[model samples]
Target: MESKQTIEAVLQGKIALVTGGTKGIGKAIVKRLEQAGATVIVTARNQPNEPDATYSFIAADLSRAEEVNKVANAIHEQFGRIDILINNMGANTFPGGGFNTLTDEHWNQALQVNLLSSVRLDKALLPKMLEQKSGVIIHISSTSGQFPIWESTMAYSVAKSALNTYSKALATEVASKGVRVVTVSPGLNKTEAMTTFLEDYAQQAHITVEEMTSKLFERVGGVPIGRMAEPEETAELVYFLVSPAASYITGANLIIDGGNFPVVK
Candidate 1:
């Protein structure tokens, strides 16, 4: 059976830019935004044909500040304005044996991809949003940021925690201007990142990836919902945060972890 819809086309007259919006959660958010009648611009290092009629595509390497500035300039030249920006492009490294085995390069790379990339993009687009005083900036964060699964992903977790902090600070700076900044931190999302993690766990456990994945979930505290969240489930949250229903909300990092995050309140 199909799941019931949780968000409607409340963004009917908006324009959105979703970075890393090719596949996985980014793709899901792009589709949902298009369905809601928002004209979305999906960006990636390599551009793919737009999937939604109301959607467009641009190519830029977000890790490079010059490319990010170019992307912002292009959007200004072409779209004139952006009402929402979803900073979702991210990458993680394979587990590096143990905590002490990690290196400075690893930390720097993680920081660039996970946190600074979003910051650079936000800096470029934020001015216009401030001018308009009516835009939403949603950052895709991770539960590991708060939970700190350091035995496995120290760099990634730390970088995301930094991103969460940036989101809060940026939100405070712009909230009074009518521009909202918020984050959605998801856990064990069944995307490419999760697939690679399972593969690595399989190697370490000397078991099949599927078996290792099952056991890994059990070790982390079984997902109370009994399954990894689908791309659509995460996308629905992105949709709401950008919609009017969540208008008064800003600077909050909403976690969707299938009960995986052990924090209380």
Candidate 2:
């Protein structure tokens, strides 16, 4: 059983930085952290088009080292320090046909977007957290990191697997410094991007979207809960991990896969 008291405005006065926070899980995390009374700063390649957006937005392609430096400098000048860091900017937009179809460019792109971006940002921002002796860093990984769908996610999975290892090692190095590092591995999420991808794949396969979705479920060893996760659902777990309630949690790769992962960890 969980305690309701842990879900209050526990993040009040805290400053949080969420990379790729304009959409999907990143957007949900920004909202969740804000609702918990944290001052949130978001970064993405483009600023969102909504006129009523609230959080501070920084436009930078985190895959580039210069851009990562720019974001880090801006945050230091404006916010001084960050209480929570969510490294959630990642993608798997490469051409799919197993390892033979992937080129050096594709592999580099996947690694830059999924792994190096977070690594560089952490290098820039972690010093502040270390100085403060209290902070939380959450790396948004995927179940594919361990259970790869090679035909579709070879390079992406490889990068995420590296991220999982890095997160654990960083957590071990930083735990005594009062900075908790955690990796969150979420399974299939029903985001707009995922919906669009499914639609495209379905059209290409000459099948109904429902049929395509079911096929995906079957391919991934079936989500026992019978559905994909919502972005907000993953956000809720992130909220808890960054809160004081999770002080004892670090060096952990937590999986929220609806039982899609066949093996027990």
Candidate 3:
């Protein structure tokens, strides 16, 4: 059995909303926040299993401005104030070729889902945060946001760059008003969907899936940790950022790519 005391540290009294919280890293965040004593409201197109007592599920299409606003309005009406916001919703598809083959539609799709979704949610919710003079916003970005890959998923990388910049600027604009905003940029992760992507790549490359995975890892110069990150590992950083323990951290993009994006910190 888990100890009650361990469950009390990361979120004792925070009220949190995590977009895309139904699966993968977002789902892990919902669980971790619940353990720390937060009333976690998770928004996605679908609902996850109901096992955690403090968790609430809201189904909505975050990619649409109207839908994003509806979700925000619901939270504002119910809670009147939000203590934390996690912008975790994003969408992208594996590209068959490099940037030359990426169409205008693909670029627009990336921007709409990955960039504008965060913008809309923040716009709808930040006023309350400003009025309260305290809150935290976490942007779940990607390593591609900065050190982008040129051949595959290039448009998604470009969109994420906009997101990273937007997050930094928003953090500065609101920090004086007592709101903290930060970004978490993860490298390639071994989520369920990513695993499926690997299998597809293996078939396309005419090699064993395991061989394809190894070659892909090699192309990226090998993850120093020798593996892709578990969703919970990324969520743990998020748990701290929204907590009082990380009150001083704002406007910074923290990368967790197993030493894949070598930055000096």
Q: Pick the lDDT winner.
A: 2
lDDT of 3 by residue, 62-107 (tens): 8888899899889988888788999999866847578778778878
- Choose the strongest candidate by TM-score: 2
Instruction: Sort the candidates on lDDT, descending order.
Output: 2, 1, 3
- The lDDT for every candidate, in the order shown, is 0.87, 0.93, 0.86
| Tens-digit per-residue lDDT, 168-236, candidate 1 | 999999999999999999888888767887887788778998898788687677899988999899999
RMSD values for the candidates in order, in angstroms, are: 3.2, 1.9, 2.5
Regarding TM-score, does 2 or 3 come out ahead?
A: 2
Show model 1 residue runs off by greater than 4 Å: 1-8, 49-54
Candidates sorted by TM-score, best first:
2, 3, 1
The local distance difference test score of model 2 is 0.93
TM-score of each: 0.92, 0.96, 0.93
Q: Write the per-residue lDDT of candidate 2 for residues 1-265, one digit (tens) a residue.
A: 5455555678989999999899999999999999898999999998787688889999999999999999999999999999999999999887677989999999999999999999999999999999999999999999989998887789999999999999999999999998999999999999877888788789888999999999999999899999899999999999999998899999999999888999988
Residue 234 CA displacement from its true place in model 1, Å:
0.5
Clashes of each: 0, 0, 0
